[model samples]
Target: MRTKGMQRSIEDFSRALEQGYAAVYRRNFVSVTYEYMGGYIEEITGYAPEELTPEMWDSLVLHVEQKGELSGLSKEECFRMNRSGQVDRWQADMQIRTRSGQTRWVSDMSTVLRDESGDCFGTLGVLQDITERKDAEKKMADLAETLCLRNREIEADLALAREVQHALVSGQLKQFPLDVMNEKVRANFSHRYIPASTLAGDFFEILPLSEHEVGIFFCDVIGHGVRAALLTTFLRGLIEELVPQGDDPGALLGKINRSLKEVFGQSDSLLFATACYLVLDVSTGMIQFSNAGHPAPLCLQPANQVVAKLESPDQTPEPALGIVEGYAYTTQKYCLTAGEALLLYTDGVFEAYDANNEIYGEERLMAFIKQHLDLASELLMDELLHDVRCFSTSEDFEDDVCLLAVVPTAVA
Candidate 1:
């Protein structure tokens, strides 16, 4: 019969059997023999503690390929290292087969036991069943690998889409050396496009309506990235279909607005875009333009040393596309002279925030244009973008930017 204290100790040890078993061993040089085994040893291995001989335990230590610190090491190596005093303790995640033929993972931890003389004797150790934890780790690893592969595939697709968008913009701009007003006037164009990410919502196209007339379409979707990029593509297709209406900027914008309304009606989320279209007759330097809640374009007059926004005649702005179906957009006119340049851009340009959280607003942009009026179209576009970036807190734009500079001159 056991005393109450001994019984309590036994019960406490038994309760620990929920996860693992503990054991003591006796050692003679490099050889080890079991001295005692307790706490669910039999329940875990399906073998009586008496039956678990040193040789049997060694046989159960299945050789497995492991990673990190345990790589290329085995139980035999661990014993040798312990005897040589190379290590104070040893730990390993090991696999073992039970009497029932079930393979299970276990965390084996042991410390070298020493006598009063500080001479090595044996080891005291614990073997905890960690099969569930190991299985969960494996599943997580597999999931991470799958996610990485999917991300790579997505990146590739986005790269292709970017290339396609670039090609489309390039194709539209190729209709250059545009002669108008009976071949007495020539039109030149320069542009810059930058995306905040792999894709952009800002898009522009130069349309050669006829020998004397050319059209410029600029738009900014509600946001950036994949969704906004898709909308830009859709808008590109709509622009192609609405080429007949392109002669009148207002009519073209009206048609685009109705088309966007029809498409957005099916979705619960609200989506919209700001756009501007302008038809320039190179011969007379007359621009017929319309706006769909977009930022007003700037006109630079080098002859007069003036810079100003091309606001509507009535100074009332129209709503953006995808809102207010059947709304009529009115076309406004502006006359350009020799040495004058028209600058069209998305809001990303002036919306940049500085380190002080102040916006590089339209006033600053107009001031920049006024100061750099003598620069060529290409140089101006590059300088404007550089200036905006310099003023930004992160030295980068948070939004996509698109700039189109149209300069018409007399063909002397």
Candidate 2:
């Protein structure tokens, strides 16, 4: 393409300017000269046709290497000579401060002029302004940074809420009674507690204040969030404060009832909870228990034909703890032989439903317990939880689910 144009002898500079430099001179144009800048350059840079000096030309050329801004020269070579009579090529898109301290972005297209014979001649140039576009790009970048910061803040808040929920239920069943009988009687315990949101209303804990005694309870508060969590904490404190020193099932429930009545009355906010509190006396092999509106406890006696769900000595579902004041709570006294086992749980366990919406009901749980009968308490706990997860196909519980099991090494 260049060879054809060379043979044509470049009759009209306009054709050359239009073909090769149209984009550079879109605003305006003038023939190559040493003394004058093209109209396009003057219009874009807010500078007069003759005001571009030799210093401006040198600065414009050097500006290309200065990053974080724009600069350079064009092919026209119009403003190579300024009023000062100095000689050089002028660069464009160079930001410069005027006498009034206002900044202007200029697109310079200036270079040394030459005739058809290619003899050395003075310089020529063109210039245009580009400040508005640069400013807009910078503003967009700042907004993007601000949005990223906001997203990080939201993520951090979610993490904090999740931690709070885990803290509420984390250490519930930690200390089990390992040395219950003459020989070391061991029981393994495991659980799955997952809330759809940051915090759960479910809570579980093993109360081991002494060497031979343990008070364990599982409770589900009415709702989810900070409020529900606070209620669970309140109920936990009440039970811990009132649980008796002696291994008396009846007394323990009575004390819990009195405390709940003192704390909360019939409020509109469904402030209720289902709970099972038990006192296990390792030396006596006596398990004293009280259930307040909770699920029936299961006894897995391998020696027996089928797993048995212990009947509440009181036939009806007792009123939940915080509802009725001064109500009598009945106690059930049972004994576990050396090799028998007892499984205690909250409603969440059996109520867990799968995608098909089938509840992991009492019947299924009993069958699982019977199947894993000969296993030690620890392995049984693990198998039972694994089975529940398999049945539900998920860890999400319908309500607060807690499991506590006690097994003796040998039958008395």
Candidate 3:
């Protein structure tokens, strides 16, 4: 028969078992017998608690056995918990064989127990099936690794494209004859090339249209990236071949439109471009020009402080080159006055916007041109770029800006 106090303790212990606590072992004070072994710890090992005697537990403690045996604990780990009455978070790496022989990884954490007098008793642990968690973590790690590799590959491809653009620009300007322009032509030409993504949408050339008439063209392709770049390249090759025919500005534009329409076909996917072509007569200082849906070039004369737009006839501005087949064009001329400067540019220069979404429009651009009318061309381009950047207040530009300027040596 159990005493009232002993029976109460047993009942309390049994309740603790339901609340995740278990009686691992008991030590008898009277018989000097340390009867260490009890509770649901055997539930984890598939063995009855009484089957593991104190001597058997001791023997299991001395040898490192398989996790499937002896409640899935090694001797050294269990002994440490027994002596210290302090349980460490431990994991048993083992494959559990199910009824169908399926093996999986599982882990559990446990804590040691003690008697009322602080004597080492046994341990109480919580086991959780963690096969799913481990597998998920491994899958996530592999996915992250794959993403890193893809990002590196994308960066490398962009870097190669950037190098190619740099090489294209390295000797491009040097090909132009700067010596023919007057020394008094205080003007500058500076350009920025940024792909809408990985290729430029704008292309400019100052090449010989003929021996007496040198041609200069600035064109903006329909969109951006590899497609736009290829189209611009095609236009460049066409300009090199077609300019030698000595066609006037209007005829040159028509030829280009016909060529593009023929090459790309008149389909909706046909590439389009806005272009301004000028054929300069070095002998008479006359510039034959045409604008194919391009921005009007500005003529700035510091002598009179006059800024004028070379006006075009009020016809509905046609779509850029290559948009429509058989589209006719016309030529205009400007008598180059001594002491006058001309500015040719793409929309990117005046159309840049700020964080507030405000456009640095034509008004601001005219103001800037008037203020720097007397500066050297190169320095002028730099100053304008700096001012535009200040207005934008950011390093990121929405489009590539290009400036080409010409000035006469003598001020009239």
lDDT, candidate 2, 220-253, per-residue tens: 6766666776777787777677655536656676
Q: Which lDDT values do the candidates have, in the order given? A: 0.79, 0.60, 0.65
Ranking by lDDT: 1, 3, 2
Candidate 1: TM-score? Answer: 0.88
lDDT for residue 83 in candidate 1, whole number 0-100 = 67
Cα miss at 139, model 2 (Å)? 16
The TM-score of candidate 3 is 0.65
Clashes of each: 0, 26, 3
Tens-place lDDT per residue, model 3, 1-412, is 2368855675566456535533334434333243443355354334465575445434332123234323566556655654565543333443343323344443434444456787655444433334576578879999999999998997787678667666665545432345545422222334545444667777777665544456778788877777877787789889888867634888889999999889888466867899988877654568788889888888888888878876465644655898778988888888777776678777877778888999998889888988888887667777887888899996556776667776544323
Alpha-carbon deviation at 117 in model 1, angstroms: 2.4
Q: Where in model 3 is the C-alpha error above 4 Å?
A: 1-140, 175-198, 222-234, 237-246, 258-271, 354-357, 407-412
lDDT of 1 by residue, 194-308 (tens): 8888889999888888877888999999999999999998999999888866999999999999999998868887889999999988777898999999999888988788998
The number of the candidate with the highest lDDT is: 1
- Highest TM-score scorer: 1
Look at candidate 3 and tell me the lDDT of residue 220. Answer: 85
